[model samples]
Target: MNDDRATSTRSETPEAILHGGDLHAVSGRYPDAPQPWIDLSTGINAVPYPVPEIPPSAWQRLPAKSEERILLTAAAARYRVASRDTIVAAPGTQALLQSLPRLRPRSTVAVLAPTYEEHALCWRRCGHQVHLVDDADALAHADIAVVVNPNNPTGRLLPRDVLVRLAAAQRRRDGLLIVDEAFVDLYPANASLAADLPPATIVLRSFGKVYGLAGVRLGFAISSADIATRLRGELGPWAVSGPALAVGTAALADDAWLAQTGARLARDGQRIEALLENAGCAVIGITPLFRLIASPIAAGIADRLACHGIHVRRFPAQPTWLRFGLPSHEGDWERLAQALGSSS
Candidate 1:
């Protein structure tokens, strides 16, 4: 891997920050590509959780307080959060991300660099002085610190102990530590800080990524009761839809399905890594959801794949890097392999 080409400071404008799953935009760019494009752009699970049937009432009426409670209870258990009261359910983690900055006064925010772009973007947009720092030790100087474990696009997983110490440092100054555990579901016991949360820390868990149900729009924030309550107040009544509540509740309780999916994703991760390596790409990041690779012709490779109707993630800042999510079906695997062979 070319470290010089891969290392870039967080200097992208909000408009320049691109995310995956934008088929419409990609289609516009590659108008003559194939029909039914194979989207391996986002880190989202290619195979989503089987959604349960929604009751008629869930569609007809507003979500009841009882329903919300039940969803939170299930999420609390699924995330190993000690108290339901400490978890605040929302439409999605994106909503919580936007709302979090508003809850506090404008202050210095330090984000572990080259992780998710949204954390720094949100804080900066909310009038905070945002610094994109290179290490956890640098984060200690800021009023709020954000860390994305098993980080997006790179698959960097910070150990629980490292995060605990960072949180402790933030606590000493009454600062907050926000840990985004969006991809930690695959190895929760090894990486998640949800079970034993540190003081002045807030952990955001994404239901859509691991569950493969991004459309359901269910996510939770685990923190102190006071912080949770404040977030709940910010998100008014029925912040999450009725169908989302039902689906989240049912999915979180299905431990068997979760285990099976995790195992499958693990196998798929290895399969993709091997495939990339054979294509002469150096795999740098490995998570159950996606793989990041480095190649001198990464941009050309992405375009070639796009022409074949296979969309992988390309970073503007890191031109040598490309990130690919797992192919959902056997046909997708074949298509990707063919595309990679042709691109090389």
Candidate 2:
């Protein structure tokens, strides 16, 4: 999607951010709200990195392997990746998440919990022994371990040295450490395994969250040369479309945009913290793209916010927690503020 593209502003309409899962499914409960939802659902960037106009030819031909090379080169530089030999570009991290398990033999896999659900789901679907653990030591006896850095929902940062040590332990057991750094672009200072990766460690990066280009479906895996070759050989050729490759290459090359966007998101995150605090909710964890608020009335607030045509994320595991993404426009902020003010 374009940088300026946004989800539905009407909670009743239920955009991609909500789909069949949340607000729309409960719209009947909030029939009095206005149309055009002030959606803050998901952790996607409200102000996306600017995308360059695509040439018509990008859509006309099959993507050449040469185009994939350019995209990988740009990604390597942008990510400060250890080496080009370590990177494997895929359609999206979801695709990588699903396929990575099958690349190796089935064995016990431990995934950090209170994180993205896909890691465990994919591993289980692939017939691996799946264990959910809260700490890194949980991977000790497993053949594989999955972690989301600057963790989702909590904004928890596990130190790199700590993870490197864990990777060494996993390595000794003939296991691999997979780190998902999907939200790391906005917080590079927060412990990342991307640069100078340790032995037997693989890092996953998603292009959609920071760039606001989820529709383009671009993501990458940074791993050993052997693993990279296996993934490439497995996916075959033209795994990424020509237009996505063209757009992603241009986006990754724009260092100025990335820097500016990081600063802007930091500021917006602070604003969200204040907004939630003023709304009588405790802002527990926040990243550049979103904030997690704890409120006794969280579920009620979510339903009320939907009544005001604003959609924010609510976690089933943490019944008293709500997550709010950055609101790009002044009007969007005002609407959210008004909704929070009057909802109770």
Candidate 3:
């Protein structure tokens, strides 16, 4: 770790800073802490959609090749896409992300700044001239553009029309566009631009967040059939496990669960947002499961909260801002509020 990077975490109170894994890491370090930790690091739903118990038959049998196809087909349908138009199935998005750059290393990639670190890391490691663009204006100049919808940490969702226009413009330059729609399932009202994106665009989604099946490790890339075919050829078969395929198919097929889970998260998120706002945190852009707040003393606040067994996430690049995720239960939030109040 860079000295500069390590310096960033020094004063942060675990409670006010909300980066993924920070809360979990802190709790792991101090297992005997009295109060339960509040993890608002990753934007995963607190009440993840319940997974139906799988049948013994599912475990006993080798997940047929068709099972994987069915999961992908269901995902395409859920996103209102054609089955053959894109490639589905990866051991989470990380597998594809790590291997993808090798396929298009010569493709000059421009990733949005303060976004997911992996976008830049993986591409750069593969010898691509990865440019990190912070401002929307800077993006207009990049040949190939990458964006994170409802960008992690900041919780900012780029306008759909704006993204579409950018993608279309990139196609004119024969440049590809990639959008990670990992959080889009949380906001269904805004359609993902991937469906209508130009032929060169690729959209990635993880079934982990919405379904709360991160352990299952299912993610897919939506692109033109040509790209999908090529990726499939490169990725080979059985990229997803039998259990993951079964669980994903089950989760996607259940519309009632999706609806109920969305509503529940929206309610819980609002309650948490109010509590944070009441504590003088400005939660301008919040999703159903997480909120991003800016505080001049965010680092100090985070460190204080950590002593009380509260953990949050913070980005070294953005010292004054923090991300907060909802706790697993309502009682967790009540305790979180008291911790924040006491620290203040």
Index of the highest-TM-score prediction: 1
Tens digit of per-residue lDDT, candidate 2, span 1-344? 22122111112221122221255655666677788766687788878766788888789989988888899999999888857778999998989998898898767788888787778777766666677898777767688988898788788878898889889998898889999998888665446777788999999999988998887899999999999999888777889998899889999999898889988887777777777888899988777788888998999899888988888887776899888888888888888888888321
> How high is the CA lDDT of each candidate model?
0.89, 0.81, 0.74
> How badly does each model clash, as a count of residue pairs?
0, 3, 11
Better of 2 and 3 by TM-score: 2
lDDT of 1 by residue, 263-331 (tens): 999888888988899888999988889999999999999999999999998888899999999999998
Query: Which candidate model has the greater lDDT, 1 or 3?
Result: 1
Clashes of 3: 11
Assess every candidate by TM-score: 0.95, 0.90, 0.87
Q: Which residue segments of model 3 deviate by more than 4 Å?
A: 1-19, 22-24, 28-32, 56-62, 342-344
Sort by TM-score, top down from the best: 1, 2, 3
Q: Which lDDT tens digits does candidate 3 get at residues 1-344?
A: 34443334332313242337655568776677666566656776666667778778677876778888788878877776756347667888877787677666355667887787777766656556667788765665766688888787667788887787787778888777889888888576555865555566888988888887777788888888877887877777767777788888888888888888888888777777778888888785566667889888888877766766777777787888878877887567767878788321
Which pairs of residues collide in candidate 2? 9-36, 9-37, 10-37
Which 10 successive residues of model 3 have the least lDDT summed? Answer: 9-18
